[model samples]
Target: MRHRGGFRCKPGMKQGSVSLSPIPTRIVSNEEFNPPPQTQAQARVESLITSLADEASRRLGVTRRDFLRTTGGMAAALLAMNAVFGRFFDVLDIEAVEAAAFAERQGDPYFIFDVQTHYVGAHYDPADAETKRKGAVTKQALLGLRRRVREAGLNPKLGGDKGTIDDLSWENFIKEVFLDSETAVGLISTPPGPYPQEAVVPPKEMAHIRDEINRVAGSQRMLAHGLATPQLGRADLDFMEMQAGTLRVDAWKCYTGSPPKGVEHGWWMDDEKLAYPMLEKAKKLGVPRVCVHKGLPLGPVEDYNHPRDLIKAAKDFPDIAFLVYHSGFKGAASVEETFTKTGEIPWTSEFCRMKRAEPGIRNIYMELGSTFGQLVITHPLICAHLLGQIIDAFGADHVLWGTDSIWYGTPQWQIEAFRRFQIPDQLIEKHRYRPLTRELKAQIFGLNAARVFGVDVHAKRNEIPKDYVSRIRMTYLEEGPKPSHRLYGWVVG
Candidate 1:
C-alpha cells in the first residue's frame, strides 16, 4: 500500500480465463469515506419509514415489502426524507397512483450508459494481485466470498495459478448490470499497472469481453476502454494503435494518478509531450473520446489527479472529448460551508469554473462514479450541491452517469437515489442553479453519455423495451428481486 522509491505503479501482467465483463474486480474498494450522520436526518428517515409504513400499509392494504415496491411506497420514502432533509427529492403524492405517476417514474426511458464499470477476471495471480495491489483486503476478501456463492460455479483452482480465485466470471457481471441495475449500455473501463495488459481488466481483454457479451446478448450494448499510459510514451502509443486497429476500443481511459513503472511521478493532461501524444493518437485512430480518471487520488502521484490540467487539453483539442471521471471530487467533504460560503466544491467547482471560463471548450465533461455514491448517503445536501453545481457549469448534457459498480455492488441504489434526488428550492433560488428536473435528470442519467459515446439512443430505446435484459429482469423480479446492497470501497477506520 505504500509508494516507495517514488515509483507510482508497480509493473506486472494480469492474466486468466478472460471472462467478459467491465473492469477487473480487484479494482473495487468498499471503504465508506462518508458514512451517514446519526443525527436529525437519520432519525427522520427512520421515523418516516416506520410511521409512514404503518399509515401507508393501512391505506394501501399491503405488506411492507409489497408497499415498498409500489409508487406510493417510494413516494412515502421521499416524503419522509423531505420531512427531515428539506425538499431534496421531487415526488408526487400517493394520490397520483391512479395517474400512473409511479409507473412513469419507475419506467425510466433514458438509455443509461454507465461510462465506468469494472470486474475482476475469474482468477488473478495472488502475488501480483492481492500482495502488491492497494485495497487488497477488501478486493481479495470479496473475491474469496464471491467464489463461495453457488451461482458463481467457480473453478476452485482457476487454471491452477497462485491467484485469488473469483466468480468474476462474465455471467455474474451480466446478471449484475442487465438484470440488477437499469444500465442499458456500459462502457468497460479499467485501472492501469506496471505492465499495462497485466493490470486487472486490461484493454485487450476488455474489448474481447465487450464483443463476447454483446455477441451473447445479440445486442450491441457494451463498450470498451482503450487503456492509455502517457507515461510510457511510445509503448503506450503502440498499445493505442493495437487497441484502435484490432481491439476497436470505444474510448480511452487514462489514469494520470497511476503512472506506468519506471516513471517517478505521474504526468498531467496538459503535459504537451507525454499526454498530448496519446490524445493525438486517439484523434488519429478516429476514437477521440478520452476518459481521464481524475479526483480519486491513487498511488504517489496525487499532483496529477486533481483534473486542473485538463483545461489546456480541452482548449487545445477541441475535437477530442475529455471526460473527467469522478467530477474531480476528492471523496467526501463537508458541504455546509463549502457550498454556502464559497458556493463551490474544492476540485469539482474549480474544474467547472475552468470549463465556464473557457466557454468555447466544450470537450470537457464531468463524470460521477464514486463521487455521487459517497455524497448521496453522507448528505443529500451535498448531493444537491453536486448535481446543481456541475449541471450549472458543465451543462446537463456534459455530465455523464457512472457508478463504478460491482465496487458499489448493484448501481440500483445510486440510480434510485439520483432519480429521486432534487435540488431544494433554497439552494436553487439562492444559487440560481438549474433545477434538477426530471427531464434534466434524464439527460444526466444517460442521454448525455449516449450522445458523447455515439450510442444510437432511438434504436436502443426501441429494442431495450423488449430486449433480453428487460425480459430477464422481469422473470428475475417475478422470482424475487434480490439486490446485493454491498459497497466494496475500502473504509478507513
Candidate 2:
C-alpha cells in the first residue's frame, strides 16, 4: 500500500503558520515508524528556543522569522538544547546573538556529500484515491507527534496539507537540498517498489534529476541510485543492466524487506541463487557500490530488514562495497531504552558486533540517515553512544553521512548539529571510543563517501563555487532567502 508520497515541504506556499524555531525539538517521522511523543527535555528545548528567539529578535530589531534565518538563530536553537539536555552540544552564549561569532566558530568547511536523499517526481498525484488511502494510514501513525504538538500549543500548520504532495516534489527538492543547505553534493535515492518502474521515484526519473542537477551545476553535484530487485530473477537482472547502462546509475539501492508481488516474503542479501546474479551484473557494469536499506523496516516482517544478512554477502563479494542505509538502526521508539539497558543499540550494535567479529570484512559501510536525525533530537546520549560504537567498531572512514533529507526539510540543521556534537568524556573513556575530532567528522561527513563514489573533493569544491547552481543560489540569497524553517515530515501537532 506504499503510495508515491516522497518530497516534503512547500516554503513558497502560504501556509497559515510557520515555525519560529530552526531545529526540530520533537521527533519527526518520515512516514516510516511512528515517532514518539515529545519528551520533557524536547518540550523545554522548544519553549526555550522560542523565548530565546523572541528576545534576540527584539534586540536585533527584526522579526522572529528573520532572526531564525540567521546563523545566530541556529546557534540559539542548539544553545537551548544544551540548556535542557545537558552539555552535549558545544555552543557559546555569544553565538546566540552575534552572527560573526557563530560564523567564525561554526563555518561550513567540511565536504558534505549526503549519500541518502530523496524527492518525488512532480507529476505524481496526491489527490488520487489510492494515495489518499495510504496517506490516511501514514497520518494515523504520526498522530502521537501531531497530538503532542497540538497539546503543547505549537504551530498547528506544520507542513500544509497531505494534499500538497508537491511539497515532496523536485522543485522543493532543489530548494531544500541545494539552495537552503550547505550540501555540496547529494545522492538521489528512492524507495523500492513492487517493480523498478513503479517506485515512488523511479530509476529513470532519478537519473534524469541527477543529470539535470549536474548539468545545471556543470560539475558532479549529484549522484543517483538505481533500484535493485533481485527477487524478480532474470527480469530484475535485465532491469539492473538497463539502469547501469541506460540510466548510468552511480550505485544500486535495494530493500530486502520489500519483496515484489507474488513473492511470499522478502529476500536476503546473502542469497546466492537470487541476489548474486544482480551483484555480478553490477560488478560487470562497473558500478561496484550497493546501498541496501537495512533498517527502518518497510513492512510487517521486521527480520527481513535486519543487516545480519549482509555479513555473508559482503564477505562473499569483497569487490562490491555494501553500504547499509539507516545503519540498520532498529527504530526511534526503542533506541534509547534498549541502548541504556543492554549498552547495545538494537540492530545497529549487533551489526557493528558482527563487523568486529569479522575484521576482514572491509567492504561493508554504515550510513546515518533517518537514524541519526531521530536519536540526536530525542536522546543525545544514545546518539553519542551509537556514533562512538559505530566508529569504534568500523573506523570513521567506513561511516557515511546521509540525512534522508527533503523528508526532514533542509539538512542544514542536521549538519550543524553533527558539527557541534561532542562525544562526552564519560562515554569516550568508558567505551574507549575515539573522540569525534574535526578530521574524523570531516571524513564521516564526506571524505569517506567521496572515496566510494569517486568524487574528487578538492576539484568539486573549487568548481562548485562558480557553477550555474552556485550562481542561482547566490542570486537567490542576494534577494533575501526564505528557508521555510519547516519539517516536511509528520510532526507533533
Candidate 3:
C-alpha cells in the first residue's frame, strides 16, 4: 500500500531503504471522516492513517496500530526509569534568578574571610625540588584517600590528579581559586603534622621562609599564620618575632603535635611550662589571636592532642582569642558509635561545655576548617545539630569559616557543602550555626577576621578589581552535572 506522503511498501517487507516525504497537513479527528465527496478534514485523516499504516508496514511489516502501541509503551517505560533515578527531583526548587536576586538584595556582606586554611610551602615554589619531591608521597596517598572521601558523601573526581606543592602556591594558588572569588581574605597554616621530621631549620632559615610567605601575600592582604615551633629554641622565637614584627603577621599557628626530644617537645596548651610562656609571648607581641590544633592529632604525638587542653588554655588567657581548630573532630568517634549501636551520641555537647563554662570563654571561636566541612557534608543532621549547639554555646559571631585547603585542596567544596545543609530556615536565621546571612557570611568570610586581627579588610578589599567580585559565585549542585563521581561541581577549585 502507498502512504499519502508517496512511499510504497508491501506487507511483511523487511526493507531498510524505505523513505517517505514529509506529511504537511494537520492531524485529523475521527469525527471528521465520511464517505463520497470527502471534506478536507476527512482527506487529511485518511492520509495520516494511510501514511502510518505504510510506514509501519515498511519498518515492522506490522499494522500502524501495533507500531503506535509499541512506541507508546517504550515512552512510558523511559518516564518510569527517570522517576526511579530521582533525576527529575527538584532539590532546591527555587529559580536561579530569584535566588540570585534575593541574595543580591539581602545586602549580604560580599567579602568572605576564610580564617583557617592549609597549604604546602613547596606548592607555591615549584622550583624548590625538595618540596616537589616531598609532595609525591601526598599524591601517592590520594588513591586510598579518595575512597575514604567517597564514604563521606563527597564526589572523588573533584580532587586534582597530580599532587604538587605548587598546588598550594599563593600566586598560582589564589589566582586559580581564591583571587577571582568573593573570598576577600584567608588565614593559612601548614597541614597538621608531627612537624617536619628532619632536624629543625636554623632560626635564620625559618625566618626567611616566613618572609617569603609575607612577600607573596603582599597587597592582597592574604594573611599567613606563622608556624611557631617553640622547640626551635629562643633563637627561633627571635626569628619568628622578626618575621612577625617585620612582616606584621596576622596571628600565630601552633601545631599541637610533639617535636623531637632535643627539639621542643610536648607544648600542650594547658601545660604552664610550655604553653603559658608561648601565650605570654604572643600577648607581648600583640598577636591578637592564636589558632591551636586540637583533636585527631594525626602524627606520633596523639598524647598531647586533646581539645580540652586548649580549652584549659583559653580559660587561663581570657584576654586572648583562641580559635579551636577542628572543633574537636568527634566525627571519627560519633560515626563509630552510631554505626555500631544505631543510636545517637552527644560528642558536640561535651565539646561545647568546654567553651561555655568560663565567662570570656566566649572569646573562644570554633574554626570550621576540615572538621566542620567533613561533618556537614558527610553527616548533615549531626552537623546541623552540632553547629546549633556550638552557636548556642558561643554566639554565631564567634563561629568562623576555615577551608584547611591545599592539604585538603580547594576551599570551594567546603563553601558549597555549607550551602547544601538542610537546617531549618528559622534556625538558620536565629542561630549563629548557620552563617548564611549576608552580614554573618561576610563576617565568617572576612570582616570578623579583620576586626580580630586588626587588619584593614576594607582597604585591602578595594584593591581587588571589580571584575573579580562579579565572578565569585558560590557553586551549588543546582548548576549542572559534575565531572567526576568523586567531585561535586559546587566543590571544584
TM-score of candidate 2 against the unseen true structure: 0.87
Q: List the candidates ranked by TM-score, beginning with the highest.
A: 2, 1, 3
Count of backbone collisions in candidate 3: 16
Candidates, ranked, lDDT:
2, 1, 3
lDDT per model, in order? 0.68, 0.80, 0.48
Candidate 1 has its poorest 10 consecutive residues by lDDT at: 17-26
Global Cα lDDT for candidate 3: 0.48
What clash count goes with each model?
20, 6, 16
Question: Candidate 3 regions off by >4 Å?
Answer: 1-109, 120-170, 192-218, 231-236, 261-265, 301-303, 331-348, 420-422, 425-439, 466-493
Tens digit of per-residue lDDT, candidate 3, span 26-67: 111000011012234324433553454455445555554443
Better of 1 and 2 by TM-score: 2
Residue 424 of model 2, lDDT score: 93
Per-residue CA lDDT of model 1 for 369-482, tens digit only, reads: 988866665567877887888888888889999998766666765787688787778888998989877788888888899898888888987876654446556766677654
In model 3, where is the ten-residue run with the lowest total lDDT? 26-35
